[model samples]
Target: MEPGTVRPGGRTARVRAAVLEAAGDVLAEQGFAHLDLAEVARRAEVGKTTLYRRWGTVTALVTDLLEDMAEQSVPRTETGALLGDLTANARLVRRTLTDARQGPLFKAVIAAATCDERTAAALRRFYEVRIEEWEPCARQAVERGEIPAGTDTREVIRAVSAPLYYRFLLDGGLLDDEAAVRAAGAACAAAKAGAFTTDTARPRSSDR
Candidate 1:
């Protein structure tokens, strides 16, 4: 089955998941430069021909891997307050970024994406989906007057994770629950202060 053609439901989904899991393991073990499609096939116990036929290039494989990661990412939950929702988002992001396997895999994928357009596009799509997933929490906050109207939801979501990523990727700092709480609190304060609010704000429905 093609990398992007597997329908979610039965044996095909399971096979695809197995392949992605195997690929992720390889990626984490040895960076993208060392990723071997044949090794992935062997580890997944799938046909090498299938892997080749589906993901023809390293970029394609990484792209599909990123898509799979995004698909497996946790969805946002409504916890009745903006801080709670953001705290959930922050903790989830922190956990993923600090995870032993996922952290290395993500670093490899991000490095590959920087040089490969297909990988870059896939990375963008992955972030887009995540941002959209969290946008509703920001919108709900606006509806409840917990945040300023016309706040940029996507930016707010990005802010919540930016510091965590920065520390993990750049400073090599520990990503703990305290860091998650700090991130959420900072993002919440920024949102309330209109840091994420739009300059070209139009009247919100609640204002009408």
Candidate 2:
């Protein structure tokens, strides 16, 4: 390599990593409303000018953070069986939502997305990536004749995580491991019953 080649994961990468970590800590502890760039710089031990020059705005930084999170997210587990696969997925989601840092960080991003269009788009993309990663589980189930032929695999994947999100975001219900199993079981049952079949899916507003 040439001199000052900035080898893989060198200063630039380290700075970005530190900054993003600091940002996540701020979001998890204080929420989006309090995510100040200067504070983030201070926490990361990076210069404020570097943060401004790199990210420019809070929304941009947040969007990048979300993208990084999606990229770094754990890969889906393959269990051959639909229920088993979904249960693994559900457990993963539960673990993330119940984690000390990740839990609050997700809540902060979700809250920000509710009112910020850019954040909402980023959040949607994040879930899209996650769903795509897990969609194969449902597809494999179809190949195994575990679900109907025309089943909407995406819906099956979404179903497995929806209840867990509801508990995490709205219901205040117990978000235990059993809850994850139950969520997976319910989605699996629905899939096996053809509830998520394309033919049974609700029509779009334009179709109506």
Candidate 3:
């Protein structure tokens, strides 16, 4: 690399981050319907040609933003128990979903994803990353004998956030620490009862 030129990985990562930050600001201020590539490039301080070359379409730009958001999220922590780890996960998710700016930004991105295939794929990838981040906590619980050995780590992690996302996006319920605790408790009880132990099986109806 030249003295002033960034390495490929470093430059690409920085440019992507800058673009996503600009995109988030644009979405928050003007909504997705008003998003413009030229404006985003101006805000990010990168050339419009560069932005267009890197992300071919508006959908691609939004997709990249979602991927960046997922990559930037904090990882889960181990607390030596399933419930504790789940509770922490819930709190972290709740905090993000309930934030004034982030909440609206996410709503815009999700709405855009619903209509754009590329954006939808990116959204799914984002969820996959988050699921992977928390899967280890559930895996650890199983290894420690706190939950069934065959528990579905992905499902358990998903369960912890499903209700939280539903409440935020659909029901308009309050997203708070208390809600996080309730979600964690529900996921933990279901996990303990082997509701998430089998592949190709739905969570036990009793868990609902």
Say which candidate scores most in lDDT: 2
Tens digits of per-residue lDDT, candidate 1, 105-178, equal: 88988888778788789989988989899989999999999987889988898999999988987887888999
Q: Tens digits of per-residue lDDT for model 3 on 1-208?
A: 2111222468877887788789899987777888999999999999998877777677777876776678789988889999999999999999998887888888888888888876788889999999999999999998998888778889999999999999999998888899999999999999988888876454556866
Supply candidate 2's per-residue lDDT for 21.
96
TM-score of each model, in listed order? 0.91, 0.91, 0.87
- Judge candidate 2 against the unseen true structure and give its global Cα lDDT, from 0 to 1: 0.91
Comparing 1 and 2 on lDDT, the stronger one:
2
lDDT (C-alpha) at residue 112 in model 3:
84
Count steric clashes of candidate 2.
0
- CA lDDT, every model vs. true structure: 0.87, 0.91, 0.85
Q: Looking at model 2, which ten-residue stretch has the lowest summed lDDT? A: 1-10
Better of 1 and 3 by lDDT: 1
What pairs collide in candidate 2?
A: none
Superposition error at 54 for model 2 (Å)? 0.9
